[model samples]
Target: MDTILFYTPGTCALAAIVTLEWLGQPYRLCRVQKAERQSEPFLRINPRGQVPAMLVDGRPLLESNAILAHLVDRRPELALLPRHGTWERDIANQWLAYLASAFHAAFWPMLMPQRYTLENDCQATVRQAGEEAVRRELRRVDTYLEGKDFIQGTRPSALDAYLHAMSRWGNSLVDMAKDHPNLWRHQKTMARDPAVRFGTAVERGEPPPEPHALVGHVELASITL
Candidate 1:
């Protein structure tokens, strides 16, 4: 399979990278810069111009959850997800939906208050609301993780990768390792995986051109296809 993942550093796209690493697939990585993401060429690739866009055999796929699902679907033996129609699969979907919708939504106002309100005076209030929502959600998730080594029982699944990438976002709001012990424990466990480590380092600006890496910047004007 000819695969290429477009990503911005420190984004949820890291979850896709982690999935790819775990799949042990040979896929290319294309670093998408902020300015280039809005360009015409990138927009052609994904109208939304979002990161975590994967081109499978040059066919584009958007959304982090969808992309991760596609990867797992390709290799069911990897068991990143439970078998279809099972209660475990249903629970996994529930968690993924919550992360994609509620958990991710809580960070927008805190990170980009201007997008939520026009009144400069109310930006702080909006941001504070976002922080509280995030904290509450994190607490709930931590409670759910009370005795689990991984989000889905003991085995590391795609949910674990998503949490690994997303829990990092909370570190800016609280001492993740201290305030969110369970979540931090999950993060720490994923960190030990060689795939997670490599993906994290590269996303944090480590040297790339590793296996399956197609070294190139996302440039609109210069795009060949």
Candidate 2:
């Protein structure tokens, strides 16, 4: 196959998965179990031991943004992103960077609390701090999203897929409706999209109807790279 993706459950990988489906390009999904990320074979493909890794034509694209950017670039006529090098593209890149760096890191405490402290007693404190950090990031995005149908230009783009995935993570930690109405509304809007819903179901480990772009799923052992 020309394209294959390795993803862990509940990670931001959903964004890329949704993007691939949106492109309607033939691609395969390889859902990795959480423990498998640290395995020797998996590490060979991605030493950092994190997920949302894409293997396109036998080469690895390890970062989420890089994977998404490649997918978007493949089908520019769809305008999944604004035209490259434009002011709008810069703004879109800014949000993608913010989500990948600040927003994603804020969830590490909750997602991998053991890494935060050697002592188990400090876990709750670390998680509480994480919640606060997530709220801060949410506030920024929520504010920016005011009176906007999507995060970027008027149409739905890869930006919406990226935001929808991360914002769903934040919603799990806080009451988005009461604390972040705009964000809550954004979530509602994104969830209604077919691609978004398909991505959501797939990440949730459900048997979602496969999209035409989904070449099918592959086993990790079957993938050489």
Candidate 3:
């Protein structure tokens, strides 16, 4: 299989990268600079001009959740998703949609106000609303994680990967560690996971280092324009 992933640092691309690493799959990494995403060459890979687009056998795949599903389905041994007939599958689907539609979408306008409106007043209002929505979504996840180690059970699933990536945004925008204990613990746990560490290192343009304890480590870095 020839797989090439076009990714932007610290974006939703991290989830797909983590999932691919966990599956022990070998693939080429194509860095997509934020400023160049709109260029013709990058646009050819994904007309949407989005990162985390995967090219499998030269066929393009866009959207993080879709790429994640493809990866897990193609590598069943990784067990990122539950068995076909289980309730876990449904729960996994729920969280996938939640991450894609709810958590991830909530932050888009705030990150890129130009797409939403040209007016400063309208853009500010939209950005503020997006920020508030993000906070609310974090609380929802925190509550859901209260008594669970992972989203579905003891082991981390694809949902965990999705949530971990989206949660990183919260860590950057909001001080989740101070406000949400369960969510904070989840982020800490994910930071130590081998796949997560590798994915994050790749996102930050750093090499993977020896494993270390991550109890007090913060998962997200401040994002600047």
Candidate 4:
């Protein structure tokens, strides 16, 4: 398939990047700055101007979860997902929904406060609420990872890739390592995984951080959501 991934660093595009790397797929990566969302060219590609939009065989696919699911289906050999009739499949779906609807959606107001409210007072309130909600979701994820290596039992399924991408934002917003040790460990592991390192490095415009630097700092309160 001739694929072109329109992406921005530290955005949901990381999800599709990770999936592509895991499948060893060859594709083009088009960098789009978040601030350029209003540009005429980007607007034509995706009126929403959102990152992680993939053009597969000339057809555009928006939304990270949809792209990931499509990749898993197309490249079954990667086995990012599980077969039908298994508990693994159910759990994978659960995590995917939780990430998209619960965790990822919480960032909407914080990222676009003006869309949420016209009043500055209301905007701040909404943004703070979103931050707290995201913290709560992170706590839930930490609990889920207490005794498991990945989201769905032992293996790193599609859910783990999605969650890993979602959690990367924690570095800018909260101290995930301080709040959740298991989750922090999971992040480190995924960051070092060959596929993840390659894709993240490409997206970041530099090499992946050293493995030692993966230990997250405890200064979470310093973040302003």
Best of the candidates, lDDT: 2
Model 3: ten consecutive residues of lowest lDDT? 216-225
Q: What are the lDDT figures for the candidates, one per model?
A: 0.83, 0.85, 0.79, 0.74
**Cand. 2 Cα-lDDT:** 0.85
Per-prediction TM-score, please? 0.91, 0.95, 0.89, 0.85
Ranking by TM-score, best first? 2, 1, 3, 4
lDDT of 3 by residue, 32-126 (tens): 78877897777777888988888788788888888998889887766889866778777787778888998888888877777788887798888
Task: Give one digit per residue, the lDDT tens place, for model 4 in 158-198.
Answer: 67778888787776777777877888989998877776786
Cα error, residue 22 of model 1, in Å, equals 0.8
Query: In model 2, where is the ten-residue run with the lowest total lDDT?
Result: 207-216
TM-score of 1: 0.91
Candidate order by lDDT, decreasing, is 2, 1, 3, 4
- Relative to the unseen true structure, what is the Cα RMSD of model 2? 1.5
Q: What is the lDDT of residue 119 in candidate 4?
A: 90
Model 3 lDDT at residue 176: 81
Candidate 1: give the clashing pairs. none
Q: Which parts of model 4 have CA positions greater than 4 angstroms off? A: 207-225
Best by TM-score: 2
> In model 2, what are the clashing residue pairs, if there are any?
none
Total clashes, candidate 3?
0
lDDT of candidate 2 over 42-153, digit per residue (tens): 8878999888998888888888888888899998999999889899889878878887898889888876788989999999999888888888888988898889989877
